[model samples]
Target chain A: MLELSRRRFLIGVGLSGLAVASPRLMAAGSSAGEQTFHSRPIPSTGESVPAIGMGTWITFNVGGDQYLIDERTRVLETFLERNGTVIDCSPMYGSAADVIGAGLDKLGAHDRIFAATKIWTSDGSETREQAATSERRWGIDRFDLLQVHNLLAWQEHLVTLKEMKAEGRVRYLGITTSHGRRHRELARIMETEPLDFVQLTYNVLDREAEERLLPLARERGIAVIVNRPFQGGSLFRRFQSEPLPSWAPEAGVGNWAEFFLKFIISHPAVTCAIPATTRVEHMQENMGAMYGQLPDTSQRRMMADYVRQL
Target chain B: MSGATWLSYSLQDFVMFGPEVFLRLFARINQDLWPWLLLWPLAGLVLPWFGRQAAELPRRLAMALAGLAWIGCGYLFLVRYYGPVNWPATRFGWAFVVQGLFLLILKGRALPGPMAWPVAVSWWLAVLLLPWLSVLEMPDLWAIALFGLAPGVTVAATVLLFAGQPSPLRWLLLMLPLVWSLFSAATYWALGTFWLMGFPVATLVLLVVALRFNPSPAQNPGSQSVHRGPGRQSP
Candidate 1:
């Protein structure tokens, strides 16, 4: 009986070990067979988070289609399997929150997920309603991060977010903007407001955020979640035809996803970059960015110049 | 800014409003009313053919169903379902109601005739079954178009009904459905729902038929002519 029990324990340990090893193996297989994920500290908490996170904009908006839901389930599975935590979504993104909820439910990913979504409506009452709706849709009691989407009624929503944070309904409060619309106002809010994180577009071509938002967030010790690292998949079209600089592999950039993502996360100010994707293969390539030596300042310059020339 | 560089967008992007916005509309409508709704489009196709005793009876019946199609879609789909996502749906719902009411009021004479049996049968088949077309060989009935929610059967029914009518007002009856067809097609295109391509294709066919079978209101006042519509080929 003792020998039998010992055998059962060994089997259990072996299976658990395989489960953990599989993800690292998958990461290594993709990243030229090495597994070491680099992380950056969230300045507010001084706690490190994996530099690469997931985004759910156009990618996870499959609505009620079971096939689409199943497809996205794999995406979230791949993300969490690779140690991805932050998942950014919005109420404006149609049925993405519901699908993400379903995916997390199916994978039993509730414990591991670092839930992040936005309130993207007008007025403070609507903000409260939308935030509750988002929580229900995501099947979570609370969120890790909640942002005022595009600063729409930002002041109104900020008050609610701060209260929620204070009440422990949410861990962090921040704001987001896109399409490069209202930077001056966002800058002022970040300076005057006590935000824990800020998400904004930053990539190879659209460096507009780098000018003001990134600098301000860093100065204020507000963790920056860089969005649109590939500029809404625009980088693929813009640079697909061009060959990667020969020296990219030296910095552990295996594909263009890494090339773009590495650039954003490598920035001293960028706490994390949430690159959105649907395909597991694409997610694997994205997680590859978290591994290896990120491009240094000169290499970042070389990468940008190559892109411009192309 | 599609106005500035419309050509710059790919055919896919030009059509897409995003899969979530596009598909969620179908899901909500489907969820609110599912198998019961399928019969609406089927009725739009099946009901009009029964009143063939009078030359104008079939035409009146067709017009009534067409109106119901518009009104049903306007209330259930445009106003109730789509109003939240698209602000313009409220106004479009009113327009559909007006169009439907016009059909109810203006059942005066035979427009021309119902589409030939073959064309009519094809409309029925496409409406009932097209959404079932799938690469995975499984159907999501939620995506299917019922009569009032969208135009799948109803548009075809109206086109067939007006194939026999030759009044100037047929253009008024035809106008909104055509625009809606184009809009639905663009949404389908964006969602990568290839089977719904028939919506836009049917719109194109109707355009050619409208130009050929009917006259510009300027070309002939009263514009009553002997020419038949696209469905004239059936007989």
Candidate 2:
């Protein structure tokens, strides 16, 4: 099993998110042993990160509840153990950033994770202040990625984010919009601005991004982080009751989680897919997508058609 | 953003936490305020009795106690507890403290018109029945959202207790509760906790009815029987 420490892993990977089939990863299957997950590189920097990352939106916003905090800590542990990195959060998510900080503190796994949060204040002047506060909240020296949340004051924040990136304060800087919002503005930003990553909503069902943004990211050599990969858990509500298609195994999808996640990460342009979950089992299932065979273009089409029919 | 763009989002999009996390707030707050939790129910029970008293001094003292409850609920529950999960809750908590001060310092006679027996029964319902709803949902005794402690129940019961106050001051006092009803309603609805959603919706209904069903001064018992001196007319 490949159980490399965070520093060793980063050094070994050398920021290449390109996939490599590991005999160790395949051999460690269905066991407590650490397994290798597929990683994709940041297009600009060639920094590799696990294609399947955890999202701390509602899942990690457990507030001051000690029990819930402890529970989320275990989930974070599960994600880290499975070789998952690139944990994404936002200041807009109430206590999510705080809870991530708490979970990191409890697990002492800060070094093992890629901490990405956003600057959400509408005041452009407060961009650095907000980032400073988020740094304290996450208990991190600096953020790996900082994005303008929902395009609020994007113009002003983008200037600050660029400066921070130049000063080595933030590893990557970008802008984000979710629930299929502000695509025109986001696309325009991608075209005009120099960004390291762009976060947007895309799932098997919500494929509006496929028409433009995904291709645009590929064309621009900008990495894409897909949010709402499960369509806020609605896809499961719609499809969980149904049986998997007979060809599901051909795509290496054992459950609905892999079925949903593999579709997103399989996209050549996608750097990662962030699906938030509160359960350890669910986190395990989500991390499972980072391994196994991703769907080819034909398989991808078949998977989409199968979901569409169902 | 266009209306079509804005309308595309759902209520759940705004609510960032689940019922599992939200309901535990009651248990957490209850545990934090153990033993002192006894005072909330005591304040709830005694408040209506003071409303019925002919003497303004007893009513003033009762309102002061109720004011203390608001301060406690707002600061301890809303600010320290719920605010961590919901940012708007901190602002609402400060508003609750202000409402508490209003109850403490505002003229007691401004809250003329003793609560009718029917309204008083509803007040009892808020005090006795509503808190248990949390207990039922979480199936934990520690999850009880006691009156004068939980914002939802406290706001509901307060709406009923102050139903008889005159306008302007009455509106001023009830404004936070009314706004709270909307916030709670949206929150609960988004969380898909319909059972918890009913409390805020009921508070909103009670507010509408209380403001609309104002009886004439001649028909009011508190106006005719309670002291209606020239100096005490304005809130």
Candidate 3:
């Protein structure tokens, strides 16, 4: 009996070592070489998307520099190569939408992309106009998701978004806020509004959402798309130097990027985590989180505890 | 948002683009305006020679060159390049053109006295040394941001060119530099590209020194001598 138990322990250790060696094999969740990313359902429609998405806040706003634009296209290609779907942008993000359009035009992958953008004007009556402009920039007939950015004129924008949804111009409608601003107001919207998704800031460090907004999202049957999953790159700046905890492999975190991203997407309320990156390697690292084993409740507590101590 | 709510935000929240894209603007603009880029620094190099002349036409020509620099930068760099990434740059670009027009239309004259040696050194530093600063940071010849082409260097040198001019015109012309300095500083700080922050800081410093050393008519008794050249009209 002693020899049998020892043999089982050695096998477990060998498998864990192999998992650390090839994250793709580990992400497959089995011995199969084919990888599978975790997908979460839109409670309203039952449609689902991979838990990892790309954000275009600063990373994609390359403007008229054709060189930079081409570089961004490659980043998009890397994303699509990995089967990434949801890509979120905003008009307030300057030329990001246009750059994305240019990239999509080059790749001709508009059909495969789940284009998500925001209506950011303060004028409540300009919802349709803003959406149209965004559509023109994205070179798409419709946006998969149209969000009232930062709850700006949310009431009026929501009404128009609903109209557009009925008109088949937008697939989903939602509201967004970031840096943990206006949570009380966002919570009110989540409680009262007919939202398909709610995007907000939630990461390992920024846990204020865990108290109310996240729980409310789950209760309202609203999908949650997390923004600033890396807290605008501050998470890596802070935690990159620290050693990954012994249990990191158990949670399937290969590097700091996956470590931070997996924590957010692993949350039951989060449908996806949009972590923006300018580098193709970082995108690959971020998408790696979509695969692999997610931490359970006890392991999550342990993850948070380790970071707080650091 | 309330003040309490505003506290939740930080500088990174307001900044959309990273330093890589911002610094690459120099290389991109340099490629777009090659050969013509040389004229800007040439215009900058001759301004002091014009400033030394007692003739009003030379001084006026100097101001016109400065005006052209502003318009060129405003159009090429801000409007065509930076505006796409940062939307508000377009409005600032138009304002720069207006400032350029002001420089072109305004009469120019030599200062009543020789420019302070320190102020001369600062102007030379801005024109000669400032463009290479970006090269030091980016380590590329194309990344060199020249005066009259790059806003930070152009604004810095302009404050010195108009140093001998009488205000409220001097103060009026200096306003944009001051604003640009603060705005650029904030942007660089938020992007965590502390190296580029020096450009705006240098502009602000030169602005302060120029304003201090070159006093206006109300402040200096000898200010009247600036209007002593041929065809000059006294206020």
lDDT of each: 0.70, 0.81, 0.82
Residue-level lDDT tens digits of model 2 in A90-173: 888999888899989988777777878888988999999999999999888888889888888989999999998788778789
Ranked by DockQ from best down, the candidates are 2, 3, 1
Cα lDDT for residue B180, candidate 1: 73
Per-residue lDDT tens digits of candidate 3, residues A1-310?
1122332344345435545766564342221332535767788986667688999999999888788899999999998877677899999999999999999999987766778999999999999999999989998877889999999989999999999988777888999999889999999989998999999999989999999999999999999999999988888999899999988987777898988888898788899999988889998899888776777788889889999999
Q: What TM-score does candidate 1 get on C-alpha atoms?
A: 0.73
- Per-residue lDDT tens digits for candidate 1, residues B1-235, read 2353445455553321355555456666777786677667666657546433234455567667677777887877777656544445657778888887877776534344434455455456555554443211224646556655674445644565554445456566667777777766766676666766766676556445544543333543332432433222223
Question: Lowest-scoring 10 consecutive residues by lDDT in candidate 1 chain B?
Answer: B225-234
Model 3 iRMS (Å) reads 0.9
Is model 2 an incorrect, acceptable, medium or high docking prediction?
A: high
lDDT of 1 by residue, A251-304 (tens): 668889989998888788898899888789999999888877677788888888
Scored against the true structure, residue A220 in model 1 reaches a CA lDDT of 98
Please list the residue runs of candidate 3 whose C-alpha ends up more than 4 Å from where it truly belongs after superposition: A1-36, B109-118, B212-227, B230-235
lDDT of 3 by residue, B3-28 (tens): 99878778777888988899899999
| Candidate 2 chain A least-lDDT 10 residues | A26-35
Clashing pairs in 3: A27-A292
